[model samples]
Target: MGTSYWRGELWLGPDYGLVQGQLGHTTAHAHYAHQLIIAVGSPVTVELDGVRHSGHCLLIPALQRHAMVQAPDPAFSLYAEPLRIAASDLQRCVEGVEASLPKLQAALEQCPRQPIADPRVERALQALDATLEGKVAATQLAAEAHVSLSQLERLFSRDVGLSVRRLVLWRRLRLAMALVLQGQSMTQAAHGAGFADSAHCSRTLKALFGVSAGQALKTLNPRLLA
Candidate 1:
């Protein structure tokens, strides 16, 4: 069967800004700041100040230095207003946020923790980590894990908190943004990232990032490219 399509969305408050978008093999550099990150995809390993987390999402506050290495596939993220809530208070705030963010929250609610012994999720993650531009199928992923599609879905949902389809779309968007950042032409980036065409890429980018690809490209740096 064909790969399923999953929709990933992020809502950022006024204080937050998008820092960088680069290919999976590319490394991004940004000053660490306090913020919350909502992962709208499968489990990803994120490194912050030399510490790492493999989970569905995280709520990191200010002064907590961080960086990320998204899975080989595309990943989705959102930056929220920083708050000073203790773990208990943070949980309450998450509850409130989830109530308001039904779709994202639902995806989070379904995520499962990674297993320590079985490394299938780890292997699948490696495959996605290897490339920033490409297509991946759930069936193939399941086959690699030596499980059926249904079993893969259950394991993913149980351990990562989201579905495979959502993870793929998120990864695609991430790659598209990366290509645009690297000075790739919109058409090139669109097709390279697996969109139907430039128009399709523009529509999806605007819908997700709240700006047209052209606008996003222009903002990539202070000096505009010709």
Candidate 2:
């Protein structure tokens, strides 16, 4: 990957939570999940699929290749959880939300309630969350959820917006960012977050977000963005 060439802040939200970015400049990249932007500093513009959308809020479905450009001003993104989307009435409430810190915080908090309508899918998600520290086979996950492997796949694809493996990688990458924020060196972050090496983490981050680990590492600020 090339130099990041952008200036902004990116931080891991709470564990097993959102990856939030205070967006400025952008390069093209495909993320692993559904993305939602609530424009704060400027009207958010997204180039998704073939068309461009500019709105106070824009929702990009998972695995859809897109780029966000706002230049001098910044917007905020919540890599929205599918279970949250399923449970919350974000569409109805986000439009009415004032683009400010306090209001946005309250609105976001109300959006995702757990133990969602489908117990099986919710159980699968909880199982996956519990297994993030170690590898869990797909079949094993299915059995733990009391569902077939194929059912697990469909549930993830349909609800969470990404495959199970991709979500696991996403979690690992977020954990890496969190470790870095806690002042771990890149090598330590990689090892603790389950990457083979710092280089492996860098490559994975670049592929997933078009930003280098070194460049993004500068953006971590625990007091402000965490």
Candidate that would win on lDDT: 2
lDDT of 2 by residue, 111-204 (tens): 7554456777778777776776567577878888799999989988876767888877877787777787778898998878777788988988
Model 1 C-alpha lDDT per residue in residues 79-147, reported as the tens digit of each score: 322221232333344443442344434433333322434577656655654543566778778877777
Report residue 62 deviation for candidate 2 (angstroms).
3.2
Count of steric clashes across candidates, in order: 10, 0
TM-scores, all models, native as reference = 0.46, 0.74
Candidate 1 ranges beyond 4 A from true positions: 1-118, 129-134, 222-226
Best by TM-score: 2
lDDT of 1 at 26: 12
